[model samples]
Target: MKLSFEYGQGLMDATLPDTTDVFIPGETVQDPPFLPNIEAATREAIEHPMGMKRLGEQVNADSKVVIIFPDRVKGGFQADSHRKVSIPILIEECAKAGVSDRNIKLICSNGLHRKNTKEEIRSILGDDIFNRFWDLGNITNHDSEDWDNLVDLGYEEQYNARVIMNKEVYDADAAILVGHALGNPYGGYS
Candidate 1:
């Protein structure tokens, strides 16, 4: 069996033993289309947000908005990619909420993963978003190694582990996470 996974700008091919059994999600799973029109679904979701008020109703002019998006490693770079389709809408809502551009920051939540390069950043976020935020220093990748940018939450006794998050996220008046649900090794979905 053979498989090809994306690695940087190129592809890395892998070969398994002849007797190996491989299962591809598309081939193994059969599910009806839940929401075929992503944009429409997103709009509907925004209209009736759960657990909180709408973006415009929640934020004020003085509010600092931080939007966290997944890195390229976890998602696709297609024209209709989640970030591409959703970010602009989020921004528009923020604008309607009177949150200025200066108060908004888009963080590529790479966590401990390798930092994405400029090209990868452009690929993950469409050119319009990249152009709108990158040059303004509003778009950035999270650096776990940068201690100053990390906020240390006191050790939790339940899991007996230290919890930490990005300082920008911690300091922001509102922090929103944008991502897709996919089967991953870390968990069944993220």
Candidate 2:
């Protein structure tokens, strides 16, 4: 008998450390019956199971909703990425939950990193999702230096940590954080 391994780049690939951990999909785990569809599997892992009917249900209908996601360069983009699955589902879910299209905002969680260009956004979200949201000016960058809108979360004392967050996120009616669960060196940790 003979076997061969072919690795393809996906969301996990962006953040995967340089190592050799054979990811045998069905063969690696034995629990919770197999998922027949990749989209379904993606939903099961990323989106909330019991929270809102869709990711949109968590938002307030009268206010703006912000969806924060890690940059694609940080293990968030792929050829057939879950981010693709998650974003549109979120859009549809938001629509179903009565959140108007104009009220939804998609923000790349770039932090101190460079802003994502239109091309990068397209690459991360694909043309369909990009077309739907970008036209509304719903997509933007995380400007870490914008102190006027940042909220100081006091201090951690031990670590001298004065956590600050974007005021847009703080002022928004709701916030949806989307990211892969892969281990990270920078401690995004979600």
Candidate 3:
């Protein structure tokens, strides 16, 4: 069987090495059939009335909410990365929950990692969502060095795990962490 793959700009014409293992989904698995609807699937995952109902209902209009997202740079770009879906979804849900656009802040969870540039943010979140937050000055970096803006969360007695959180995150009335639940060597369980 022949299949076509969409390669990014630089990778066009690149040939797959013989060591590559290609597995066809249906042929290999005994799972049910798959339905294809790109826009609908995207909306279901990233917009209201589908996956975000619970989160949307819990948020109160009067409270200040900070939505944290993992920096996509750490895990190179993919067509269906959670970083792409989570931000815009949170924004739409926040609007539905009666949260003011100004009160909702989008922050990159860079931690000690390199800061994400405007272009990177735009690439993570499409131009529309990026422009909305960028224009309002609501997007900012997580500066781990700014002690004045960080709060100590005490330490573990056994391992002495010194936990310091971002002030903006701690000070907010509520925090919504939007991250992909994947296994990692860092062992950050949820």
Which structure among the candidates has the greatest lDDT?
A: 1
lDDT of 2 at 4: 50
Ten contiguous residues minimizing lDDT sum, candidate 2: 6-15
Question: Which pairs in model 1 have colliding backbones?
Answer: none
Q: Against the true structure, what is each candidate's TM-score?
A: 0.85, 0.71, 0.69
Residues 33-99 of candidate 1 have per-residue lDDT tens digits of: 6667988888778767999899888899999999999998886788877888888898989999899
**Least accurate 10 contiguous residues by lDDT in model 3:** 1-10
Candidate 2 TM-score over all chains jointly = 0.71
Q: Which residue pairs does candidate 2 place in steric collision?
A: 149-167
For model 1, the stretches where C-alpha displacement exceeds 4 angstroms are 1-31, 185-187
* Residue lDDT tens for model 3, 33-143: 643754456566554545445657777788688888887545635546666655666767778888898888888888888889988877776677778888998887788
- Model 2, 1-190: lDDT tens per residue? 2235533352222344456465566687554564568687766654566654545446556767888877866654665576777777776767777889898888888888889888888888888878988988988888898888689988888997888998888888878777766655567654
Residue 22 local lDDT, model 3: 60
Better of 1 and 3 by TM-score: 1
On a 0 to 1 TM-score scale, where does candidate 3 land against the true structure?
A: 0.69
